[model samples]
Target: MMNINEHLLRTFEARPGEFLSGEELSATLQVSRTAIWKHIERLRQEGYEFEAVSRKGYRLVAKPDKLDVEAVLGRLHTRVLGRSIHYMNEVDSTNNVARELVQQGAQEGTLVVAEQQLAGRGRLGRKWHSPKGKGLWMTLILKPRIPLHFTPQLTLLVAVALCRSLRQITSLPIGIKWPNDLLIDGKKISGILLESSAEEENLNYVVAGVGIGVNLLPDDYPDDELRAKATSLAIEAGHTMDRSEILVAFLQELESLYDIYHEQGFGPIKLLWEALSVSLNRPVTCQTPKGLAEGTSLGIDESGALIVKLQDGTVTKWYSGDIQFSS
Candidate 1:
């Protein structure tokens, strides 16, 4: 299993240029020859390039193109957020993997990151575009002691943190679009999806999944219509971006803001979120299950609900709705 992979990885790192014979590896690892062979096969399947000669044995050649974990860990300044990272080159979804870890007793601040997602998703079951080596797809597991009703505030807090991080790293003007979308030049660049599990009166765990379209080229977008509505950091900056640096910066920002929210309350974070919010004080139309409500955006409530002030001067609080700007 993973133990064997770790052992092989350590051995390969220690003596990369030298070849270790099958018998020598079996004896050193204290495993059967069949086991060592199987582990090597698995490593090959996992994208670790290896050269095997008949009598000379196996030699590690190259590593898979992936996110630089060392670079990310080196720049990471938080005590949490990425203390323990589960990195994958490819996965179904980081959120799904993080949820599975939470069910198996993963600690708070545990992060699951993937370079590519085969089945990534956004809110309301919408498909999220995730091209390999082009974006950041990560999920963080959190176990807060707060009430279940207060969980939604974390979504807004993350939005503010992402906005700050993006500002620090790039010159692009990034803005928060309502609940959890991040926009650059009035086009979508990133989104956040928050899923939670709760007990009767307490919160069990929450998984906050963040997807940033970082290094995607303009031509990589699937459709022309969608391309007009979507954008990436590379497109806006006119250059390729370092995913490791951005990911580390984002984790640090999230950890700092999360500490503030846990110690004080959502009041302070809400103020920051509102300041970066682009939808407030603008004419907007919200699509609700009931019907469409057209009004000017007021602000978010104490519980993070979107507040809309209708033309009739009646203010309504919306818990879940699709928001659109009105010209």
Candidate 2:
């Protein structure tokens, strides 16, 4: 069956705020008038509010005040990141939706974005605050042919891209907090989560989900303790930001970096990531599931693992761990 919602969305965008006659819609869609009515009802049920005038027709009054697909796709300048966008007004999670689509054979570079997530998550399975119309919750699917071991490079690539993009767009002193978190003045501002599907010798795809605390007010965070540890770009910048613009910039940066990684490998990107890394040359304590270790952060290896120089002048490589700076 044809996707009625898709058809309605396209029609609404083509003739926004203009009356679209039911008969004309039926004729154009080649469906029965009953089907057109049913689709209209479904769209209304899905939060699309329209004005039906007597004998005039249906005029799209207001769409859900969420991330408009037209607005986001219009601002996108990349050929891939937003070529296939699945925008949701309210979803459980963009990563969850992206995973389901990947299972259904969705192509690489497909993006799933949600204005609000009921159960958004971060690394280590922590709950991410995703209030409505406040933050950017998005997931991008990538099917790189690279080996499974090289997947960590993707996280590093995203971190660098986000830091650079934020620096260019906002007047915040954004810095990377080791592995994947973006921080401004020692508080969390954004995070990146990379989940991949791979077999022993081959790789299927990678879902890189990024959640940015953009335009969220301090009061938006319900928990007092959590609010103290988290901050948003809007709060830091003291004004509301166009989340669509930030999304487009981040996607463009990701695409550019991905192209570079695919063509030249992680060598050049690693250099850039290290240059922007705030952990390097700083005193830090690495907390792993095994134990706690203290060291002076040296840099990252070619595999994207962190290099820590211990007090004994011995350098150790860490694959994965929660890093805490010791001032």
Candidate 2, residues 49-148, lDDT tens digits: the string is 8889877778888775466678878878897777899988888988899999999999999999988999998888888888887888999999987999
Each prediction's Cα lDDT score?
Answer: 0.89, 0.87
lDDT of 1 at 95: 95
Would you estimate the TM-scores of all the predictions? 0.82, 0.81
The local lDDT score (0 to 100) that residue 266 gets in candidate 1 is 93
The reply for model 2, stretches above 4 Å from the true place, is 1-65
lDDT of 2 at 96: 91
What overall lDDT, based on C-alpha atoms, would model 1 receive against the true structure?
Answer: 0.89
lDDT at position 25, candidate 1: 90
Residue pairs whose backbone atoms clash in candidate 1: none
Give the candidate number with the greatest TM-score.
1
The pairs that clash in candidate 2 are none
